[model samples]
Target: MLGVAGVVVAGAAAIGHLGGSDSASPTVAPASAAPVDENGVPILSLPEPDPVEEPQDTAGKCRADRGDQKSGAGVIAAFNFAYYNQRNGEAARALATPTSTVQPGPELQRFIDAVPLGTNHCQKITALSDGVYLVDLSVMRPGQPVDRGTQTVTTAHLDGRWYVDAFT
Candidate 1:
């Protein structure tokens, strides 16, 4: 009876030693997200986007080679250049009758705003009188062909300089 009790105790001790110790160490933990609030909700928030502003001519103003001339074609070219480039101030000064009472106002803004970003080249210039001219312009816009027909613009010589008066 004593020998059997001794054998049982040795078997239990061998089993406990086999299961207790381990050769493998624990793996390192991976990085995790930010901590949560007391209510178990995440605290992270996304940033807002910036607003878009209107286009501006940071590189001074748009200029043309023959914009200051006193001829009908020159006046038309200068006006068109200024209009397309959104240089309203230059257009008002360089393309209008020097002595006329008309000022650059909402009407000019409406007219220029209607034209998309592009150039208008003068195709023909006919002198209707000593002080008036009929200018035919070929309007061109980006991603579009040259306009199919000519737009006639009437310019007048006043205050000893050429000025755009009307268009048809």
Candidate 2:
């Protein structure tokens, strides 16, 4: 598992340098404020910010929740779908950050290439930290026994989306 994580980090570094130094970062819209008239009257018809960043005493809100469990689950699901089910390396890579230092391009490609084509199912997902999750997975190939594994996946909230940063 640690070896695979290393490959992913290497792959990310590789992806980052693929286009040289000219790669442009994606733009994200800032959280918006409510509209008001010159006299401070509320314009109730306007759309409001989603308030995803509001502080909360409970476990659901804060900077920690910016890359929430739901997003982590989705990314892990998509990664599994692309890696095991569809065998689409490009799609799997898309779900990951391109600038990770631990997973460079060659290692990442090797990792992707080594993934066995099979059916993958998420058995359980546990949020271990704010932007990280522990995913229990079941993988089975035709005429083979089911294999179970657990991976700790880390994510980052960048450009308004959660990106897989590393996993082990």
Candidate 3:
């Protein structure tokens, strides 16, 4: 799992140097405001997730709920949907900060592009509070046609939402 996360993050970094594709942004609107209905009505309060089940606490909002053993599946799914849907331009604009940069070279870029194609999935999580975590995203590298990786992430509670600060 850790192996997979490493691959995904390093890969993204690599591709990033080719230039952050405007398409690499996320589709979802920032989760800062409120959970709105289709009609745009605001949702006040929602139930917190079961710590034993979800581990992530919903006392806050967005992807802020995170704890040990958490899969970060939400992050993975959301990121994929956003980028794959072509909503990545402005979404990535938010990451244009000093924290966003790639190292480990172009192998990192190929690693990212090769990630999803490898059938890697989030295996487990190690929570580091303040919306940060170590996510294990990988597939069985049992000599199968697959690649693996891990990512050390730092997420920030910004605008009442969890925004990825950095991944490496």
Candidate 4:
């Protein structure tokens, strides 16, 4: 009877040794608590997307050459073509003065917003002075009658280039 009891004790010890050690078990990380509102509803927070930068020049090449910039009528033609036809504000701004309203800002945004749904064509350019001109514009808006009006455009010669000084 004593020998049988010793054999039983040895067998139990062998089984316990085969169970596994603490290091053999996989470690599990504790879950973090999510953010909640007053009613315990989870609140989601996302990061803002980055802004896209527009190129200074486009494939159409709306910028006026030196000879065109030398003439007020030419400059106005190029500016109107770029601003009203192509809807290229940057290209139009290149033909404007540094302090002109066509610069990239709220003033420029207003012009961009006011662009017609269809197209604008320069009809006639009458020289008011050596550096100024009266431009006759034909505006065509979608689902609207064609409208014709005249605007005063002033030009300035700077650094061997002519820039639109003021437009009204």
Candidate 4 lDDT, tens digit per residue, 1-168? 999766666665565566653343333322356688999987766688798887443212333222257567677777777777667777778888888756774456577778666654545677778888776667677777878787788898889888888878
Candidate 1, 111-163: lDDT as tens digits: 66677755544345555665455555566677778773544556777767778
* Winner by lDDT between candidate 4 and candidate 1: 4
Best candidate per TM-score, number?
A: 4
Q: Tell me how many clashing residue pairs each candidate has.
A: 0, 12, 17, 0
lDDT, candidate 2, at 105: 42
Cα lDDT, all candidates:
0.58, 0.62, 0.47, 0.68
The TM-scores, one per candidate, come to: 0.44, 0.51, 0.36, 0.53
Q: Please give the RMSD of candidate 1 to the true structure.
A: 22.5
Highest lDDT against the true fold, candidate: 4
lDDT of 3 by residue, 12-115 (tens): 66676567556553333333698789999998787987677554443223231222122333443344333333234343333322354432324444444543
- List candidate 2 segments past 4 Å from native: 1-70, 101-118
TM-score of 4: 0.53
Better of 1 and 3 by TM-score: 1
> What's the ranking of the predictions by lDDT, best on top?
4, 2, 1, 3
Model 3 lDDT, residue 77, Cα: 36
If the candidates were sorted by their TM-score against the true structure, best first, what order would they fall in?
4, 2, 1, 3
On the 0 to 100 scale, the lDDT of residue 16 in model 1 is 57
RMSD per candidate (Å) reads: 22.5, 23.6, 25.7, 20.4
